[model samples]
Target chain A: MNNSQDLPLKNDIAARFLPLIIGLMVYVGTLCFVFTLFILSATHLWENQLRTQITLEVPASPGASSAPLQAQVLQVLSKTPGIQQASAVPKKEVETLLQSLLGTTLPVDLQFLPVLIEVSLNGREPIDIPMLEARLKIISPQIQLIDHRPWQVQVSSLINASVVLASTLTFLVLLTALVTTTFATRTSLLIHRQVVEVLHLIGATNEYIAKQFQVHALKQGLIASAIGAAFAFLTFIGIAALLEKAGLPSTSLSSFSIQAFCVFALSPFVTGGFMMLSARLTVMRGLRP
Target chain B: MSDFIAQFVGVGHQYKKGAEIFKGATFNIEPGSFHFLTGPSGSGKSSLLKMLYLGLKPTWGSIRLFGEDPLTMKPSLLPLLRQQVGVVFQEFKLLDHLKVIDNVSLPLRVRGIEAKRSYRDARELLNWVGLGDSLQAYPATLSGGQQQRVAIARAVITRPQLLLADEPTGNVDDDMAIKLLHLFEELNKMGTAIVIATHNQRLLERSPYPHLTIRRGTIIRTPKRSKP
Candidate 1:
């Protein structure tokens, strides 16, 4: 039967409120996704570029010709196998690096900090850090290797926390959407109890009654998801622009994987399906008694 | 199927934590027969009709509709059986939000009939009931008698095998009540079994149909007059 014309009870005031609520929730969820994507992409870039690099620091000898010692160290590093290249960092460049961190006002005692040398590995063979340190002691006893592994571990932990937080927020968003749909559907059932009775009296099946709510919820979900997804997309673009202005790595939206952005298109359908499922379950439970 | 449209043997109904509403009642209604149930307020007439229409199950004793015991009927089969029966309540029970035509077409729609065809039939029935101009008007806009007619139109739209009406003439004046009676008579002549529960004595005296009078949840039967 064409029961669509039977009545307009499905689209009540409460039903109208669902889309906006769901939209707000979806907005929150999509924002979480964007944050996680940004963190992962930046971490991946850092890993790729820094994994094969090492640094050596040389203490300035109090009374020796620092030039001769620097020259000798550079010569020994060049002779080591698996070392693709070695160069003494310019003092002025090291000061520039310090300016970025410690600012331009460097204390006179801090000027004796150390001379830094950057070392690159060919990546084809593994070099033991202890053996390399022992060999480097022959050129100068003050040479210390600074492998980036510990720093990488710290960065990995930070990325892991971001991902966990994003996943938790997305889960909460889904739960909120499900709870809201259930509340709306149940309220509608209570509000229109008389209508339900009349329909039941006329031999309408429980499935038919439940379908009324399902269609209404699906429509609302689609609308809310559209608004939420669109807002999320715009927010991501804005964040990308801000990050680019601030010189953060991987600031472009396309810099992330396609799966990262695909969420924007799929959000509405997922929420719509969630809404339909919630309505069906709620209506059936309401009608079963 | 049993030859009788409805049969009740020592049927009883009792509400939870409440006194008994049915006190061991027994009765039968033959197919294509028309009978009137006369009773005062709270005489259990509506409750008995409810049992016959599967709105409630008998607390004790055997009860059958269309020759099958409704007690053992599966829930999945309820809609199919309910579609074969029609009921008009004392309150008219019309959905206030639905228009007159949509309200009248509800039974057919529940039976899986297409709205296009049901609306056409609903329109014709509304015209027949002198509510043709009110087709597009909601049930809340109609008078008490008009709502009652819409309920009748809905009940009989599918041409159910049996029709049970509780206090069909309760809200209307004597003239309107008589007009509604003529409508029921026409449906009854078409081989539908009809059982009307009412408090109007004028109707009982004017018609030759047998009367089943209920008092204190007990029934007293009076045979129909032989045609001259």
Candidate 2:
């Protein structure tokens, strides 16, 4: 049923080595893809949470409780045409967040914590940031406006860099697999030169002989790719678990992105096809008298 | 595929022109004739066969196989033409990994015939060659004589229009050698054109087929005998 195994050179060193290298490439390729998805998911969530609001931080000053400054800023913001609504974050919430970050709030410095205000914009008006800054500065020179634009730019750049790196690695993995198949196919051709000669002598067309090698390559490619795929899948699960333990937002390695699932699913078939093509070409070239 | 299986005109061959291995050689075999090609060691017997099989183009002459110029034939067309020809190697070029039946069935398999479906023909041929019981055996496990028989079985299994063999019986005993010759005889009777290259002089006397002796890349035809 499977005729490629009937080929005498099937047990050659290169033949066995092909699957191992292909499997490793798939493993690394899957990791690169997974990391890219993780970045993408985190970036999307961060963008949604940060998109509509602007924040202002008011530092504590000597002999001045910032409650009055915060109320004045909010009153001024309410009068501004572009401001939808302005609200001051309670001091208790800020301290709770700082305690979680700094791991123990110093009792003495608790009252000295900065006052934070959130400003939501009405989409109908384009609020000028510098004008808002000058208006806020008139109330208190210590107020700092934190525009979300720079953060968005930085996040976009990071996401773009990661996407490009993942794509480059994917390209490299395919190239490596192709080179491995080509080299292995050539070696098999040379190893079985006499058998090939006999086949030729007996009236086998170059295509027929090439078909034999192609079938062999396809089988090998599929088998090796499956092994690689299984290993990659398991590694993703293990890495996801590790990431969860490290207190990071773990990627849904368990989350089936239909796109990623389809790509990984077709990888073995693509590998087999590549092997068949490369084998056909290599045999055709070798058969040239 | 054609009335004439092979034809050569001024067909001389050399790896390089002017430093010929053999030169200006011409020969032709009819559709169903059986012939022996005999010459000493290092003679051009193998080279001549190579040209006949389209393995090598003549350096400065013409070669026609199955009514097509081998030199001008499209590279893609060679396989179709080759399928009509069969060859048995002196080295017994059986794929050692394959079982005896598989080896014998390769010619048909290469042509896209289902190997399992063609088992009957392979079985019959192997049985006729005294290898019926060894169908499941590998070539490495077979003796030189057995390996040679497998090679012969493979060559003729396709019922090729032309069968070319190089020292097919070289490793066999004289009794087995005669038996092998008779197998070729049977194929020849079936209208398969056959040319056997051999160094065994006993076969030259044992049969009445024409001998196309090659001494220096040229055919020296022996006096004819009856085709009994």
Candidate 3:
């Protein structure tokens, strides 16, 4: 009999906290959705910028060696404030990448592959590629300074599109939360209407009733958010793995840094708080004449 | 611990100018005194009960309970005072969602009684009301007489000093009404003040105690208490 009596306590907990839990889960899920898109787009933009700094090509002529030309370009690059480190890439390494893309055997001579020099920059100021090209031409007319702004602009635009999309999704998620919270609170109040009346008749203050709802909503929100976060993380990891297998650009989805993850986790608490506020307002309004 | 359980002086109530429900109603229910309020339909029997239970304030004049004017009673203290007064509705307003035992035990629970003790008393009262086998049944599943029994059980479970019942036996058969009357008499013997509102002449004829009759929002026969 005693055990059975405690069962109602459990029921009370469930009834009070369930909506909060659901709210939290939805909040965390929305955050993860936005974060995943942001990470993929941001990393893609960063990688694209890294790839477009320079392009090199070598002639089939036996005398066409880039070693001396690379040395001269390095001298000019060292003096440039924005230039970080510049070094020539070995021909064999470039050949290997081509082989992976183009096949093991080729009709072309190995000398035709480019001796590429990789440039690292401070990214401080926009590179004056034309002026640098004129200076580089004085050392070796074959030397060219590549600005990479066209491809950078393209990648940046893609990043901007991603941001806009994520922001739109975030807005939709917030609106959904607001609607759900309002409806859930309203439904709960309706269900407990008589109990509310009884309490009022017996002299329970509005603040007391509001406190009960607040506690229950917060509890539900936190539990639901935790579940939602876990589910979103699992989905993110699963998608990242599948993409990796398909040879697409794959970064660690689980690599969501502490600060980012904290933001994601906090989303549920915010939702619960909103729900609590809505419930209090609804109850107060209903109690009024 | 107040000298007066309830007091109303010059109380009047009306609904939208149809007719005054109660006009210049003045009365006092002394501590531990039983009262029976009787009247024909629309004579404000229920309305007077409402004022006593704090459900409605008199349209005119002052009303007090527990020796304090209700209008000035702090809202926070209202629940504590109400917990001491229990009411049974004419329709047997039992919560249909709860089991009979649960419904009877509600007052105790609301008063912060531990479930273990409250349920023990609830089970005993259910048995006393001849509802021993139906403890787990919901109000909706019970017969009209059974539901009234459940309501009475709930009303008295808290051992309220004042118990107000409106038309408690109106829905029950004559035999069951007599049985419920004995139940109320037993509670009254135990020092709980009981007020039952009903139109049953046969039942009223059997009781030796005095009762007040209302007509046109006025008390025609005021019950006089014998001096202790």
Candidate 4:
């Protein structure tokens, strides 16, 4: 609020702690970048669950025939209450999905891939997998049911761990920022010792000196945070472009809601508040009589 | 509650890991009076002054400032009292990073005084001290006398009720030292209490004020002088 004086607030701080600030910005930026990725992946996994709940496979032994079994499985799925749609995925589609994991060139011909029937369910009712499997067995003795719960659990766990890891990294970044601000504040105080003592002599209160530091650091940290957030956004766009070109799953890391966007916008503000607190505490403690 | 601004009774102090420095020292500084504290090196003059400034507590006995006991004063309230007293240290202690004007204006700035007004007043004081042209110069580039003058300007800028100078003229020549002394005297004339600690006999001889002489850890005597 005191504007009687103009401080080269950003310029002076950048000059004094250029490397540290840059490093902080880059570290936060990278975390934000990865956070976006995790959010997108989590959303994709949720979307996948909403779209496909079950997979039915049929074996192809010497005398086995999948065409009749596929028809029977589709007929059973259509009668189920929660079942919305059922469709047979041709052999080639399955082979293509396996190609990524097995190799570009699979060992056998494309027709050799197992016949699969994808089942999508609707309405909020949880599917009874055991009953469905039992009813599905009456259609074909060779039918195998994959409810996708196990895979969903695995994906959810991975997403949860990723989120927890990102949150932990963000916490560590804040701690580092506090430590960094403390050191800078101490150095600044030592450099201004005479000024401080002179102010003390002039009857200037300790709170007044501490305010200057707090305000100055708040500005510094906000600027660094803006730079970091900007970098994060740009990196997100670059990664999105890379994934698009690679023809990978079209997952989106963009802000999903106002709240999500606000959280991103507030990153710098939170960082600034932390730096202000650390600097103020450091200055007062150093000047304590 | 009386008119006395400061009172020290049976005060004693010592540096850690060192012998007792001051022993049962006693003094009183009235609301608006100029006094000089003189002592040789190792005579504990700085230690005694530190006690007066509340920078160090007396090892024994009681001291009072502004009618309040310093021994029991809360840390939160000490700054309120300290801000009413100005200090000029022996080494000048000017911050090297700030320009001369900024250095001179620091006390006012620290007091949360408006910077424009503080700077305006600081420039005037610097002009008064004959260092107006050095306003933008850093302390390291200025002569020792100029730095001391800046220090003096900073000390008086706040218009504190009590001004303490510790060998302020130690780094200046005879003429500059006397000029600095006169500045302190001028502030004293305006009813700001002044205390100057120095070993310079010339300044003592030139000024006409009561003097406290210290030897070892105690005040040897107090002398009254003819009016300046």
**Docking category of candidate 1:** acceptable
- Model 2 ranges off by over 4 Å: A1-4, A58-92, A102-115, A120-127, A135-143, A249-277, B1-3, B15-21, B39-43, B173-178, B199-208, B215-217, B220-224
Residue A260's lDDT within candidate 3 is: 49
- Please name the candidate that would achieve the greatest lDDT relative to the true structure: 1
Alpha carbon deviation, residue B165, candidate 4 (Å): 2.2
Q: For candidate 4, write residues A1-289 as lDDT tens digits.
A: 1233222233344237733573465447455545655576556767577445788887665455667767777788888878878888877777778887789865866444557878888856677778988997886677898876676777767876877777677767677778878888887778667656655655667787788778888877778777776666566557666866887455343433343345557777877888899989998899786
TM-score of chain A of each: 0.77, 0.79, 0.74, 0.71
Enumerate residue pairs that collide in model 1: none
What range of 10 consecutive residues in model 1 chain B has the weakest lDDT sum?
Answer: B70-79
Ten contiguous residues with the weakest lDDT in model 4 chain B: B219-228
Candidate 1 regions exceeding 4 Å error are A1-17, A51-144, A249-251, A257-261, B1-3, B16-19, B66-76, B172-179, B189-191
RMSD of each: 4.6, 4.0, 5.6, 5.2
> Which parts of model 4 are misplaced by more than 4 Å?
A1-18, A21-25, A28-52, A56-81, A84-118, A142-144, A183-205, A211-234, A249-270, A284-289, B16-21, B39-42, B168-182, B199-208, B215-217, B220-228
Candidate ranking under TM-score, highest first, comes to 2, 1, 4, 3
Model 2, span A1-289: residue lDDT tens: 3344445656787687787888888777766776677668667767754665789998877677778888888888888778787888877788788888777735646567677888887757888889889999999888999989677888788888988999789778878888888888898888888778777777677887788889888888888887787777677667768877987654443453454566667778987898789889988888886
Q: Which stretches of candidate 3 lie over 4 Å from their true place?
A: A1-62, A101-114, A122-134, A149-154, A184-238, A249-281, B1-3, B67-81, B171-193, B200-212, B220-228
lDDT of 2 by residue, B126-210 (tens): 9988999998988999999899999989988998888999999899999999988888888899999899999898888878988
lDDT digits (tens) for residues B1-228 of candidate 1: 688888888888898888787787888999889999878777788888888788888889898888777678777677777888889987888988788888888887777788799999999988987899999988888788888888988898988889999888877888978888998889999988999998788887788999888867677788997633
* Candidate 3 local lDDT, residue A84: 68
B19: Cα error in model 2, Å:
7.1
Q: Rank the models by DockQ, top first.
A: 2, 1, 4, 3
Candidate 3, A199-243: lDDT as tens digits: 555435566566556666666666676677656655555665776
Stronger candidate by TM-score (1 vs 2): 2
